[model samples]
Target: MQWLFGSDEDILKLVGRRGSFLSRIGVAVGIKDSDFPVFRELYYEFMEQFKSRYSVYTPRRVFASVDVRGILIDGSELKEYMLFLRDFVNDVVNTSGLYVNFVFASFGTSRISLPGKAKPVSVKTFIESTLKSYFAYIPVWTVIHRTGIKRARVYVDSFSTSPETPAWNELCNNNEVYVVSNGDKVNLLISAADLLLGYIGTIIKLRNKKPDISELKSYLKPFGFNDDRFRIYHVGNRDLGHIIYKDPTVKINPLLYRPFPIVYLIPELSPAGLLAGKDERKLIESSHVYEYILRYVEEQEGSLKIISFTEDFKHLSAGGVVVSLGEHSRRIAEYLRLLGFPLEHLNARELIHLYGGDPRL
Candidate 1:
């Protein structure tokens, strides 16, 4: 009876404010059936203590933003508040035997909304895409392969925008993945995931603001929050890419590829630099290449994997066809060529032309 609980942050609404640097993040925590009761008890106790101490009543769910906004907004209390959440999370993980995985995806709203178009593409579309890419596919794949669990009961916090994509259905059918609404009265794990994602988002913000995070680092070290136990994936943003590349321990296990071959789709840097850019033409072309490859892989019925790659060069050894798009393809091809890994390099426009699809479509 393995269980995986998932929730996401910065998703209900897109951060469209000029010059905002926040990212959408999702968390999935896996635990055994026997550990569920323990986790439930720990969560209840933590909630009780938190409510009593802060006078914030969280009867239904715990939102990191709603519950800890005061602490995060005040620069003076941010550190102390982080430590408090860290201690509680550590207690929960240590006591309940929880395994954590995170995915971070950043999008530039202005870039997504093309200037001349009558209506900009909805941010919800991108959010749904990220949810499908990060939340539904990778976590389930990793959990099944790592835990040796034949099937996992997955509970995801409800998102009005998340549609039942083919990937979701395929994963569910193939792996016995069950989607439970986080709103279910009996589900406390989703709330726990929410809290963890909030903490992670704060940590990212802190890292962006200042250089000194030694205190935070020390607190997270004991629990392996930044280590192998906690897997983290960056979907697109170059900024988050830098963070993932700097820490080798948080990488996706190459062994996950043992069950099936993977197609590593590397897109150009985002306007945010080094991943997909803000240019409408390049972005659209990249999306076309991504969709074409994704459909091609999905046609194999879950026998293949496709993931977005940032700067993590080590995964090149994972033994998969590497397809790089945009101007960055040349650089990636050269790097892989030097490493003796087989490479297929094509710009987004070329891939689109080869596939006989219109980029604007």
Candidate 2:
């Protein structure tokens, strides 16, 4: 099956008692090609409804880009914004033939700086960097890896200047990537991406305020916005590079489970447990091991079962492979190592090569 991916960004500059800073939010959505007609119908209906309510004309292509910001101009318009988003999300979720997946990344601009340059980089450079680090490479690779699809098409709303870096070129070489202008006649998914970006940007702005947004948060839960699909790299004054919020109940490649179980021993304060606080970087580093193992098992058609380091050994089957993640589980790893299992610090790629196997598999 073919997948269409679209991306857009919302940049916000805020000034408060804590001082002024910038927040850049990039959102991407992936939809099946078979579902685009239904999505287009829903989008057109929403635009017509919006135009009737506000008495504002919404051109076919630029409806979301030009009109979504108008809904955020004041407090009174917030109600309409919430209602619009609520109805849109509800309708999309209830639709039978549509499958939409969303992924968003937020970068806090306060602690960002070039390594050697004294002066700051231009807005275009920042945009390119955000796209490279979070938007382009990871999102496309995640889709390809999860779906086992050979190729997917990506349509990014034009940033005026296209990225020319080697990473960007490599991405294009691997998949069909296009940077299309807002007025592009065939790029309907870009408008959906823009709408999502605007809604998420509003959530970031009001999250710290006294006004409660429980209802808004609730609306996004169905879209998996509060789950693994959402990632916050940096926010406010903190440079939190590794704090990823993912639901523990969600397993990687749920449908590809085999009877042979690979047990993963996690730290007591693992990111999956939502307790990675100040040790987020270390925890995230160790998470790569779990990710690698999970991917390997997925390719092997095996299953993975996660357990805390302090959990009992009752769940471990005889002669099963057990792997420990993070420094906190070092002792357990050592014990398992002595029992003839693989090392806890093993690299899956190197190990596969050592066994004269295909590393890609």
lDDT of 2 by residue, 1-361 (tens): 7777766665555566766444455555676688777877776676677767777532232346445556545755676676576566566523523333433333435234443447766534554453443343334434444455546677665442322333344445666765543312225566666666666656656653321235435555654343433333222223222222123232222112123444353454554565754475355434433335533443332334454434435334343554444445556556666766543343344444544556564
TM-score of 2: 0.47
- What is the C-alpha local distance difference test score of candidate 2? 0.48
Best by lDDT: 1
Candidate 1, run of 10 with poorest lDDT: 239-248
Model 2 RMSD in Å is 21.2
Question: Which regions in candidate 2 have their CA more than 4 angstroms from the true location?
Answer: 13-21, 53-62, 71-76, 93-150, 183-186, 209-361
**In model 2, which range of ten residues has the least summed lDDT?**
250-259
lDDT of 1: 0.49
Residue pair clashes in candidate 2: none
